[model samples]
Target: MKCTEVNRLLNPYIDGELDLQNVLAVEAHLQECPRCNAAIAGIQTMRTAISRACEPAKAPLRLREAVQAQFAGTAAPRQATSLSLGVCLAAAPGIAALLIVGWLALAQPWNAQSNAGTAQGTRIVYHLAGGNHVKANLRTLKNHLDAEPNLQVVVVAHSDGINFLLQGAKDTEGQPYIGALRELRARGVEFRVCTNTLTRQQIDTRAVVPEAVLVPSGIAEISRLQKREGYTYLRL
Candidate 1:
């Protein structure tokens, strides 16, 4: 099998979705290809980082009480209802997961200083996941810096957020966004583009604007910044 064929099959192979024949072909190709092997390692590292970052957080007492109340409120009258304490307890985990997802979707900007033991200084990780808000987000960043000159900012881009970081990418005025990116870089803001997105989208590394640095995984990088570097998380 050729490198291109193996590259196409890498994800399926990792997921154990490839049939035996194709699996063997990909493995054989990987054995002789350093590049493919490194790709697999990078993916596995990202998976591990994500897994660590996603470990189930204990539901807050209020949320748990609300969930329990919700379950109780919807139950039929005692004589007709089959709901029990054991059933509610058993269902708590799944309900908590859904509630957590919803909470994340509705979450506002979080300041690291509010948490004990977080590092000092105003360190922020501004996360971007869509192309539509690039200009607005950058404007917000500029305003933030103007308000707090000593603040440290890192812009982490993934998915369609990487669009503005591509070479020749333009803003509403038909001017390239790279000029704004360069200005931001000059102001000590770091722009990180995800290499995983690049590979999945088949974008050449050189196609990214020189002002942005490529990281293994934008999500993983965000996780690291929040958990390990004490950076506040702001998704915009």
Candidate 2:
């Protein structure tokens, strides 16, 4: 084994886990390589330090109670309880932080911690009724998202309004409406089409913007969002 290969096994070896073959290989290399010998010695020192610092066992809660009771017997009744409680509560914030870190570690799309100090999320809603010009309102929504930024906007299509995002939809100039919706969606604009309207009109959802999601009923979804999710609604 090379110096690097032997170094890789040093920690496990110092912890007494190296296999027979690996031990023989490591021994052969260490006899001749000063670098590997030093590496093994360094890892052995680290193992010794870690073993002395901590052992795999239960927490120190029992010891903590004893410490708290040391002053508890002399203090007044309320003071003793409060001091004991404070001693026990000392780990609360740290435990909460550890839980949050663990959750964020697994929840992140990438393996990373979620920053609590990041900007707050944005939530905005757009109401589209039957027969209104869709291209114009969609353009306005796009402009706001592009310029103001940080604004989370949802376009709710209901009733005849579902045509705004119907498959193969076009503007008065014959430009494909789905293209603009796609572009806006790439910038984070959410398109929600009312299922009630689609069922009534028998429109094919396959033709709508791929970003458009079907809600139970667009009007009801809009109302629920405004009342419950704290969304500010705008009608165009």
Candidate 3:
């Protein structure tokens, strides 16, 4: 990884948001790049300082009761009555302090934890089984890859879904899918086809797209990625 890429990923790395692949890349770069290492150290120091500065003090009982009542769908106590100018001036300091404390208490670090994989970047297994929406599915995959450069994505296509992976296949709108598929492949997306489905449909393996890897079973691949590799599954 270059210094520019490492700089872009530094915040996520600090917040534990990077996947295993990216984490390794960033760590490797940091070891060789003294400037990048110092930058990360400064970031860590800033984070620690802010966390300590924003440490929350206990909230008043009234505020706790009001918050609890809101969550429980119960009526809360009425707001305080209007105060005279002199009374308002007297209470302003305390109100400001309360607001500051409350805000600090609610403040949190930007720690993006992936539910799919613990201590790793996000890994997703997208299931494509409908012919009518093949274009949409591929489009969504491209959008996801564009949005999350660090994401690990795999598309498992079987049955009708495998139609899109066939050589010379066009989408519902009669537009070819190869161009988009190629671009996504360049972005680290993996396309998998079910050999079982091809056999059932009497489709030739030679006719499948060169980009797709043949898996024994689509469902089995999905299950294996989810159970063994901690990939999140989504069907479309």
Q: Is candidate 2 or candidate 3 better by TM-score?
A: 3
> What TM-score would you give candidate 3 relative to the actual structure?
0.51
Looking at candidate 3, what is the lDDT of residue 102? Answer: 24
TM-score of each: 0.52, 0.47, 0.51
- C-alpha lDDT values of all predictions: 0.70, 0.62, 0.69
Off by over 4 Å in 2: 1-121
Tell me the lDDT of candidate 2: 0.62
- Candidate 1 TM-score versus the reference: 0.52
Go through the candidates in order and give the C-alpha RMSD of each one to the true structure. 18.5, 22.6, 27.9
In angstroms, how far off is 111's CA in candidate 3?
Answer: 13
Query: Over the stretch 1-236, how does candidate 1's per-residue lDDT look in tens digits?
Result: 88888999999999899999999999999879999999999999999999989997997664554344323222222232121122222434434443333223222223222442233446767777777645766776787778767668899999988999998999877888987888889989999999999999999999998889999988778767765665555555
Q: Which ten residues in a row have the lowest lDDT in candidate 1?
A: 75-84
Off-target runs (Cα >4 Å) in candidate 1 are 1-120
| Model 2 weakest 10-residue run by lDDT | 79-88
